[model samples]
Target chain A: MAADRVTLSDVAREAGVSLATASRAINGSADRSVRPELVERVTAAAARLRYSPDATAQAMARGRTTTLGLLVHDIADPYFSAIAAAVVASAETAGLQVSLATTQNDPAREVQLVDLMRRQRARAVVIAGGRSAGSSTEDLAGQLAALRAQGVGVAAIGQPVPGVPSVAVDNLGGSASLARALLALGYRTFALLTGPRQRTTAQERCRGFSDALGAGGGVVIARSETPFTWEGGHAGMLRLIDDGSLHGVDAVVATNDVMALGALAAARERGLRVPEDVALTGFGGISTLRDVVPALTTVAVPMGELGERAVRLALTAEGDVVESVGCDVVVRASTPDLRRR
Target chain B: MAADRVTLSDVAREAGVSLATASRAINGSADRSVRPELVERVTAAAARLRYSPDATAQAMARGRTTTLGLLVHDIADPYFSAIAAAVVASAETAGLQVSLATTQNDPAREVQLVDLMRRQRARAVVIAGGRSAGSSTEDLAGQLAALRAQGVGVAAIGQPVPGVPSVAVDNLGGSASLARALLALGYRTFALLTGPRQRTTAQERCRGFSDALGAGGGVVIARSETPFTWEGGHAGMLRLIDDGSLHGVDAVVATNDVMALGALAAARERGLRVPEDVALTGFGGISTLRDVVPALTTVAVPMGELGERAVRLALTAEGDVVESVGCDVVVRASTPDLRRR
Candidate 1:
């Protein structure tokens, strides 16, 4: 069966050239020894034979595969999916294949995946999502350094990894802007739904929103920290509602759009009308969540752009740099102008 | 740097065993010539040295890579994302890495991806999505046949490919059932937003719903063909509404859930109240879409299970097989029981 595959020797025979010349021409060798006419003849013969160069052999020769590894927390989540999609599109333009791995939000699993990518000799790796605090970061930093040492490009999307180039979203600034926007909407008292303390993204967003609210002379009546997931938001909102935290609260702020959606669902279940009864706001304006009824007020982080930039930074950037992507505070029906009334 | 990587010889030297014995023990060679104590020593030595096997070398040696190639229409779409996430999870359990590629619903690109996967010597390839008609299908079939000839297993989700194992959803039956369920709700007239003519999934779904409606003495007053996407559905619905086609329609059926959500958005934009002025339904029970307000009435296709079964079939099946996955009609707030009213 292996013999059936068209090889450089076959192309060389068909093109009336030596095997070495065919290999040099087809592999685009840096040596300018192969004649143009011979290169053309070899190319035409390979095309005629429908020959595909073995990727494994190519990787062995190059010492790195044309594989861009993307590590995401969960592909099913719209946030990660959006990023993954962008990465795939960008990788395609660069003529690279994407090897996608899910960490399932497990730092150990993430470390293992990084090792796997390293072993595979992937040309580049883009890690999406926030980093949790602890030894996992140290372990990851070491692994990334090893990968970089091996000439494999590495980039991070969320929090900046010590010496790696990263595309960090302005989480704190975005959340603060969203908070000020909500304050302008005449929201004085609020309930907050935040994510776990270990995640830097959650912590930054929560602090930014709270600090901004305090500066605006607004108050956070209640707060609940849960997992960074829709279900977690739902449960946290339910706990707050059940504990009678919304009695005088003017609005509910969820740290992310998915969480805000879950909060909306919980509010609906409890017979609370959005904007009319209690206003709401969220962060990370995912486009897929656009059509949600009453429309969510959110900080529109350019999720896809983040992915594209990360891929670019990984494959092309020089030196350790932190590229910041800005966010816009999109005021929708979820948070209305109470002052106008 | 390549010299820095630990080799089998390093393990053999550390274990005080012959290179052949180390290779046979570490790679689990069929020949049981290596002694058990030597194997244990080699394994311990390899572990102690933190030696990660070179996947590229292993692939070349085995004539196949431990890669599961997954081709999806678009990963950003919740439907494909759901299936992709499942495929990744299932592949992980089998110790296979998923090489994801998006065809962007282009058959030429899909064929090219298949060729790319073949070049990579992927262990198995799972193509998820509907097939388009014409020369592209023949081209794809040829590519897939070539893949199988090289001992690479192949499986498909959605429409079955010739001489390949597939996990096919009951699209026709699901739509028929959905139509009947809607009829039971006392809806007499309907407007349909369908996909392009070339897609088998769209064609089957449209025919099933329309045929069932005709058989049940219900009428499809208007039908519009658009791209099988959210924007298409939105545009199709808006066109129908503007053209007065939906004036007397009791319900609107979009072939897929994303399309249905688009139609719902269009209806809302037109100031039409769901289950009052009109009702709406979508297919493919995407879990992410569960939070949409008014809740969607849909035929729940087990997307994750489809991916899991496809991986299993591609890797383990001995013969061409078609595994049918069932769909269930889920009644929700969008479609009300008009008879009660």
Candidate 2:
């Protein structure tokens, strides 16, 4: 295929230039000599021949660039930010460079950004937050398979991107722990604030919360599905309070910190004292949560560690890849007394 | 300067081939009729001449590729996260794409990243938390100057890069506002906690804080500088408490959220109740702080907006261009409280 494709020689022949001269014209070497007329002809020839210089081919022939690419949904999210920091720190230790990219969780933008990373000659790629390019898991599977064939490393955070190594907190385990904590506080009725039902992290956390709390068949009478944004949490909590169900429910466990924080605000506006009147718990112990009043009693996933591990996994050889690791629980003062205040 | 370089015609002449055939040999786009021997000759001639394709040349002839490069210091910092989010959203809105590359305040990495971004043909470049390459501002300046010469749109955030356009907050005003707020509440003595003196934002904020309060007859006594990180703030606060001079100060002004949070923690350890005892205020109203007890009195910087603006400015031509905007002060219960606790 390389032989048949229009090579630099073809452009040289078409422009009636020496091989070295053609290379210089194409590369724009500073010290080389060239006539304006010859430069124009060489350019025209290059275009006519559809020459690309093939960045991928260059990588293969010249060894690796020792760079990897990382794309995420929202870097502002403490979860992603924590992971990113960890990843960069780790990458530095490994003598590898990371190229970071972000998608606002827009699917089209996700595909476009990933494509560009591939072109950058990245030997490995990490996708955090959003789903892959395909509409179906199978499609995502195919994308992974394609990357495998090309010898590119791929890993993801959040939902395991088809065949990629993924690192996550045992959402189910952690949520169960949180639920048990709230349950012990003698909270019968519960208000569940959830995230987008699609993402795996949200779903698993919800399941964990339910499994531990409802395991004994207590009560989880109220719930709302909102975006995993701070606003969503704020709005969701307000809605729970407005429904008057918050009065009946003794506890609130948001899928993430933002929602949990929002729930706290809503309870406050409703004249409820946290832990006294209504115990509130959030997941994802981000730095922001550390300063929250009655510091969040939540799960602290090693976000930065996840990022670094994800990168290492992607860079690992194809067949020898390890699976995933679990995160830990971080309990603060958010849930003090369990009963209604 | 562009015209004096070697041309493709020179290669064809040396290879004894027609211009089109030489072009084919060089670019690897040749029909079955093109002989392998001719291609060899073309490649040999090109190699002998040491050809290098002009990156800018290829870009001009080709339509813009769908990629943007973003550089920042620490993504884990809520400030950078907000900016990164804004940039990604803005880039998505513009139908342009972005790839992230973090410098982590390392000058060598910064230079390497810039080179990588240039090689990737990023449509524009945004550098947040940039520093001197090799920890020397001179080296960092030299690289930025080189990129400018190549016509790369350069925009920075948090601090000015001499000739670069920077999207930064009114740190001076914001700090002054916080100080002014405390003064209004009758807190006379203060111990300020600041980030590294090298950080532009940190320096600007310290200046603002001191200018506003220090000029008030040294009422703000002294300040300690720490890393622009949480632990730094924590350690600084501890130092103040152990030094026994804290009794002379009734309030503390921290430069940023992480440090402010550390201060809050330090205060709690010292059994100081917020507002009623030692009033506290933090700059950069980050997430989770809203959930903290006494809700940090802070300046809610437009972090996302800063990021979006930085991306836009990076896309524009460089010159004496400047954009500065005001931030909002969030009055929580941390400052000198007038309300009876």
Candidate 3:
């Protein structure tokens, strides 16, 4: 028995009870048809045996584990945090618990987490992502298919994968509006700091900015690409300055708030005045920028709403599912005043 | 059968296999003298019969579930988010999965999550605080104790619970140094926007700030306590201004970055010059703040490391473990230049 796995039957045998009764005792069920002493016996037996209940079997017998898995690329960003919060709130409302896992933009981790969620027999899995520089998400697609084949519901945030419910901000529309905001403010020179190019969100944002500013009678633009992070923004802005590429650029737009914050810092270090000598803005309206100096003028996506929507869809998906959401722009002091670019 | 809770034995009977053989097949143990086709048969039957392995039973049989539950109050906060990222990284290294839930500082939610996590048969559970205004956590102390009695390793962030391992920041030391920084700069009057007074971290911060200022000679201190959030900070700062008390304060020390950002806006709205009229400093060196205008000088906490540590303790703990770790302060611009102030 020491060399072999100790199963539930062993515990039941030791406690002189049926397997179900043993389960009831370990689960702390209040009303079993057994004596209190029997409950105590089962409990002692379980403790002695060190039982870790089979999640799958319990889920099958108990109707559900009342648990869901949340998959994200990273959790440190306010954007994901916002969505994660919503997912938790919505899952609780539906009587299901959600657990969050960050993939760190690694598709291998993505596949591992999805598979683990399946093995744990989670009621549902909500997968969210940002940009990934390495590994193709084609495997995520396969995992989605496998889980669906096994009757597990799946939800996606960011890009809508086939056969999964999705919630996403309108990366293009938000980026376009931000670019238009900058253009209408009369800023001619523009610097861009985008997320990993492969990420659909970053790609859409870049496209939106280009269309809004480079279309028809648009102004001169100088652009550079940087990862969607504060460090990237800081370094990208510095690179632009060192290269003298920012000499004529009057405005800088980052794909996300972290990068924008970085750009703002870079500007400050160089003695550049924001919204006066240089206007700075970004996409995601993370909280840090909400109250910063010359509060960032950017788009605020309903991240919590996205997380909530994803969970609701995963819980209630009738069949193969797909959905999308958009974002709204918040104007603040960081953008150049309309009267002066 | 539909009304009779679906059982693994039912699947075994339907698949015409012995219980042991069925267990081996369903668990995907390929080396147990079972043909691949037979293994496939068992799994297919499980899916068809909706057999969920009992989570509690499975735990007893297996030493691991590859599932971990992370409990927190707010995922949107950068500190918590950082910790979450760290937890994910560590969990990946251990070949485990993470499940996250937010209590929103609500004690009832906290109770609900703990119960759900137990049912899900998580190997470890990590609880971070939620702002509980109505329901007292005094009731939760019992629930947590019961979980401990169940033999599940639990870890926490912020403050330690009895017999549970927790990761805590050096709130007193960090706040003390921040206050002293401004005091050394000869700032006599201070407006302090603090976090929820009920939280242990916030209490320590208050004590530290008071102690620092007291050592430098008594100074007039105007303070307001609010929940840690952007709106709370903004409203708290506004209150100081409307009360005509802000003029008497030369600097503001907020307990968190979000609140500090709010204070910055309040200062701007009140036409008070930053660093010129009232130097502002905040706790939590968030990535988003790196972009704020004039930047914020504050203490940076390794939120990610905290998350990782909490998870590690929970995963590796043996019996009745309690642990604490110190936090380093990250200096930012929110604290004014000592010479200038």
Candidate 4:
């Protein structure tokens, strides 16, 4: 079937040129030995024959694919979806296609994807979200070096990978701000729900919040390590409630919004009201959670901008430079004003 | 710096073979002209030199990219994201990569993306949203034909384009069922907040719901065309409320979930309670909306499975086939049993 179709040789025959000369002219080779009239004649013949050069061949000669690779923890997560959307938009404006991969927070998978992107010779690669503490970063660094050796640009969003440009949210600063605001509200005792200990974002947030509360001489009544999901938060909150330790804890500090959402569901199931029965504070200002009544008091990160900035940095910036983006502490109705009381 | 790197010629020299034979062996070409011992020698030499061929050159020789192209309306929209996640998962299992593009509901952009995918020689192309009613399908048909000429596979998720295989949700059937359920609840008058008329999904959904309601001797009190977004729904609902046109309307039926979310916000702004003040129903069973109290009554479509099935159909199916996936009508607190009253 392919034999029946018009080929580049046919175009060369029609254009009355040698195969080598026709190939050089039609492929737009920078050799300059092919005359202008010959290039035009070959191009017109190829157009008349409706011939397109093999894309892979075109890419090989050009040393880069007109593609960018995006590695996200999970595209199903609203946080990551928002970032993915931004990356797509930016890539579109740059006339580049985006190939996405979900690592499921697996370090090995992330390393494998980076290697794959290197083999594809993508124009750039963006790694979104935090890295796991348990993973071997040394291997990833080696893979990244290989990509750089092949001239593929690399940038990371959220995680600070060594030798890679990055745009990370100030997780520590944001959580500390939230803690101070809660302390100002006269919430002296709190129950904390954190994500997996291996997640750097969770660890940083936990340390920041605990540090700030300790500075204020506030008490952390109880703490639980939850998965970075609603179910994890719900289960942790349930455990805390069942342990009969809810006598005087004034608030629940959830490390992330999904966990906070789960905490809300757990509290509701136990016939407790937010802010009134027990105040709640969450990290990660996800837009989906913004509509909930008694809007969650959380630190809002510019997720879309994070993706856009990462792409921009990857495509233009040089060498292992890292850029940190700030976060805002949004005090919503979930934690009411204790000053009035 | 690149000049210092080892080239394939160096490997050929180390292997003691002619350039052509070494190239064929190292690229794993099926020509079978190179001797077996010579192939092994070339392979070993290439491995020792750590030589990786330029990816583009390799792709050109192979005649296809190990990637699929996915065109969606908006990646940030949870509906598309859910499907994208599923598509990525299935593609990974199949050992294929997915390159994504967002058309932003523009017909010209969609055409451009399809052409781009064709130029890239993607394994398959999936269009995951509605085609605009305003655009001429003739141009799109031509593009699809060109893709077919190149041996590229094509499939669509929501809209049905001529000569393209598709996996579509039963929008008409699902909306009709939702209409029946609402009528059974004894809601007499209704207001509809619909997406842009250019969108086929919105059009089909509107036709189905209105047709079913009209059949039951019910009236559609007011209808407004809005953008397919929460903001659009909110503005449309606000207009309806301000017009004092919802006087006897018992419910607002939105074409999709995002609009319903907007309507919820608009109603709350007017101090109107859901179910008690005015009932609401939405199509597209979004899990994010499930967490809301007075859980949204909607038609549950298997979003993730829709994507997986579309990919499977694209890769395996022959001819212009259209498969309709069924949807289920879910009853929740948003639409109560008003028949008893």
Tell me, by TM-score, which candidate is best. Answer: 4
**Higher-TM-score candidate of 3 and 4:** 4
**Docking quality level of the chain pair in candidate 3:** acceptable
Badly placed stretches (over 4 Å) of model 1 are: A1-3, A6-51, B1-51
Cα miss at B263, model 2 (Å)?
A: 0.6
lDDT of predicted model 4: 0.84
Tens-digit lDDT track for model 2 on A210-329?
Answer: 988788566788888988887888888888777777767767778988788777776777777777667777887776776666677778767766787787788774563445556466
Compose the digit string of candidate 3's lDDT tens values, residues A213-276: 8763455466777777778888988888778887777777788888887888788888887877
Off by over 4 Å in 4: A1-6, A30-37, B4-6, B26-39, B53-55
Clashes of each: 0, 69, 43, 4
TM-score of A-chain in each prediction? 0.93, 0.77, 0.82, 0.93
**TM-scores, in order shown?**
0.93, 0.76, 0.82, 0.95
Best by lDDT: 1
Please provide, for model 1 over A27-137, each residue's C-alpha lDDT reduced to its tens digit, 9 standing for 90 to 100.
655334688888899989999998888877777665678899999999998889999999999998998999999999888988999999998889999999899888998
DockQ for candidate 4, please give it.
0.60
Please give the lDDT score at residue B103 for candidate 3: 72
Model 3: lDDT equals 0.73
In candidate 1, what are the lDDT values of residues B174-251, reduced to their tens digit? 999999999998999998898888898999998999999899999999999989888999999999989899888999
DockQ of 2: 0.21
Model 3 interface Cα RMSD in Å: 5.9
- Ten-residue segment with the worst summed lDDT in candidate 2 chain B? B54-63
> Comparing candidate 2 with candidate 4, which one achieves the higher DockQ?
4
**Cα deviation of B158, candidate 3, in Å:** 1.4
**Distance from true location, Cα of B303 in model 3, Å:** 2.2
Tens digits of per-residue lDDT, candidate 4, A188-248, equal 9998898888889999998998999899988888889999998998999888888976669
